[model samples]
Target: MGTRQTAIRRGTNLPRMGDFNESVVLDAIRRVPGGLSRVELAESTGLSAQTVSNICRRLLDHGLALETGKKSFGSGKPRTLLRVNAEARFAVGVHLDPAVITYVVLDLLGNVVAHLRVPTPPVADPEQTLSGLSESIRQLIEESGVPADRLLGLGIAAPGPVDVAAGLVVDPPELEGWGRVPLRDYLAEETGLPVVMDKDVIAAAIAERWAGAAAHSGNFLFFYLGTGSGMGLVVEDTVLRGVSGNAGEVGGLGAACTTRGMVDEAIHLGVLSHDFTPIGPRDAERSLAELCRLAAEGNATAGDIIDRQAVRVGRGVCAAATLVDAELIVFGGPIWPHVADRFLRIVPALVEKSPFVKSLHPTRVTSTEVGDDVGAVGAACLVLDRTLSAQPQSLLLA
Candidate 1:
């Protein structure tokens, strides 16, 4: 039998040859708030005037951009200002947490048009959970009033060690039935739209650079603390996608923080055991709530747990900084708000005490300022960034 080849479609775009030029122009216009004139676009992109004008005409015709107004300076002619038409396109972002699911619809401007959250289906049944997710997406589209035809695609942020090359989620015990699942295939078919997937933290890092606090931060790290620890990196203004798309799975770094009769692993407070039961599975969501409740009541055990986990997280940050020299480090995930504020304070202290990082320079550590929607918003930004952001790496192709 002939081999069945599957093609992953990441939305549609211009042919490869000319897309490079179009992408460059689009990126420049997106960066400028007041928009740029033909001359300005040509100057910024290093394209000839005729080329910029041609590309501009194409973008405007496609509704990706519009003539906002005209500008004049000195003896220069009043040049027509062009700006991106944010409403021209939209993207759907879904964050598939083990305990909770978050969905958001974003216009081209990275604004959340609408968002909703619901309890995630049990991980034991992939088909049923995915069906529920698909229906939720349809409901979102209907409620948000976003034209389905204008959607770029659906982007999913999930726990990783994902085989992104083939769109498979690998061995996430948190997602019980997701062992090597062809998630993109199932979701794309279910939702009737193209799908892109990445680790939740990685998506959060992209969101910051696209629309959050780190819009201008090119080299930074995002430390994700939710059900557990995860990390994402940005080097030279691009999110690092390492082999298998799981470059920053540093949760194991907390091994040193494990306690006996807990995870048989790290002693960090993130290890959630019901009724002090050792070796039993933990409910991360309930653990989070419990930890917060106890900590608020001045429970030293819960407070100490958070501190120890932050130390491990800081050590991981030091490792990344020494290896790649990240300039900024941002923290996000549901866990941050609950216990990581104390974690955040302790992280910097630990980092400063480290000989490696202190010898080079102190890496800036901060929590995400994007609110509770960091993961979901990042997922939406992933679609926009992949489709429109300037992708210089494509030049490596023949």
Candidate 2:
């Protein structure tokens, strides 16, 4: 194959020689919210005026940016103002859960142009779910009137213990009976697009970093509080996937809390059910919610149970913060609303007293706005980011 053909096959979007300069220019434009004129772009990019003009012309011709207005000052010639045309490109996000499957179509600006939610397809056959997912995506694309070329790709956020590097999902506790499924390859084949797979919690963290609570900050933790709790860590804008890609499994940490006599306290407080069936973070949230409702109605049993659960959760958070050295912690998933108030009031104290954290140092804890769609949105953003920047590390489609 020729060099251009070879580059395309390799999935490298830019030619080797001038890719850095092109990326720098694009990033500069992205940073400028209202976009920059040619002259202003020159100043911001540190390129010569002629170079900026050339780049702007090329970008405009490529439809990456649009001329929106004209700016004139000091009676000089009016310069055309530019802005990112988010609709120029698009991405799709899928959140696959045991109970529901959510699909969202997002433009480059992270705006949802379309969305679909339905009961999860039967897992006994596996193909049933995949086919349903494919049909749903096709319906969304057809209804949206978005061209096939503009459809960047799809992102899948699934239950965890995923081998992200291999694009496979291992045996997930909640999603039992699904043996190491080739989710990335299957979804890509079904949609005729590239599909990226990630743990639900990790994807939520990515969405928060891009469009929600942690939009500007780094070194934060995203706790996806569901039937199971999953954690995603971000250090300096990159999601930290540990050696095994299972970095933030906090359920195991509860065993450590047992040493502190918190387990019995949890059961006694009714935050944990006396029922022997295995429970997870979602169960904790459910218990907390029940307690909160009772507390709202002036039930002492509910109030005390919630208070005890808050302490246990705080212990876990403090442990994670100390180990990861996270500067901020964000909570999302089903349990957040139930425990947000209690967590906000109690976690700080527990973290402050912990030996792991530095004396007098504070870790900012907050709730996430992305909610359940965090995974889907983050997945879409993942593809879009790769498409725009063409970075080797952030591959969206295979």
Candidate 3:
């Protein structure tokens, strides 16, 4: 099929009597800085006052939150205060790519306590790869000397399109026969921890929106230019997972010869080979990396190849901006920083000169400081945003 699409099937539910009670209460308190009274929480959440009181007590007891101060606005007297501890629990985030896997241990406040990187498996074998990942997680936890129980769980930023709900790598073209691999289940079973999965670009966008530059922009496009290219859209702090959960597969937007008037320039230039692997998720990383190095080395032939790639990328961005109406575009893939200083200088001009830019200025394009770790860090942020937000299970743990 020309388009990569799949049905997102749900997994069996894990029991959770207290999966997110304290977190919900704490997030509410943090929203209303001065601290919300039990009555206010009840009014806001529609939970009974007694339920709110019980949750607040648990939060206070666990040291995840406290009644810093009290407020008086009624005749009967003021209720005790409640606010997020901001230093309560911690989570481990690991982003796995073909080249490297980045590990970040973040605190409740989203501060990075430690960050590390290790090489990924050279070959694609699920059993071997997952065993190494389990070892990595254990080693990082042991080396940091943090109690395993203190960690909420692990969030993995997986490369390529994934079935987030079921935690499977569905039809990953880059990996040999990786289709329908139950990654989440394998990792969770091996590590004895709950694992959450997200597409790398989507995870990167989550990290950017939660803590990076795009945090302020509600409607933004995250252009993840890693070994390959992908995009993610965040509309009002929420990711837009289109019909088949493959909304941001920009590489598959179809490579037309935008450099020339016709599409055959790519064919004539020999940059793309039909006999080779199809330009699906399977061969993007290897192909793009070779092209980036050639372009960087000032090889005229390679430069021409990359120029065509850039034009195609810019056109894809234009199409994405038009379709999603994203206000800001942030670049955060591996290739960006290598040539960002030079790339940015020419991108806006090319975009503006395009036919689509006549009315609306193409979305603002900028580099992300998050860099290579964007996906892994974003994986961790997904956990935090899930366990610490008003609706705890709505995003991460779900």
The lDDT per prediction is 0.75, 0.69, 0.67
How much lDDT does candidate 1 score? 0.75
Residues 322-396, model 2: lDDT tens digits: 777777788886556665776678877777777877555578878886766677787787776656653435433
Colliding pairs, model 1: 257-266, 257-267, 257-268, 258-266, 258-267, 259-266, 259-267
Identify the candidate with maximal TM-score. 1
TM-score of each: 0.83, 0.77, 0.70
Worst 10 residues of 1 by lDDT: 1-10
Across 340-397, the per-residue lDDT of candidate 3 in tens digits comes to 6546766666666666643554467778856668888888887887766544244365
Question: Which regions in candidate 1 have their CA more than 4 angstroms from the true location?
Answer: 1-17, 70-79, 255-283, 358-362, 396-398
lDDT of 1 by residue, 1-398 (tens): 11111101111233453677777677677666678889877666667787788889999999999999999967977999898999999999998777678999998878899899987765476787778889999999899999878999999988787877788777775677667778777889989998999988899888887776666567788877665567788887778878768888775684433222223222244344545433212344454556656767887776666676677778888888777777678888766777556876798777777776746555787878776778998999889988988676665567
Model 2 quality (TM-score): 0.77
Model 3 segments more than 4 A misplaced: 1-62, 65-86, 255-304, 350-363, 392-398
lDDT measured at residue 385 in model 3 versus the true structure, 0 to 100 = 72
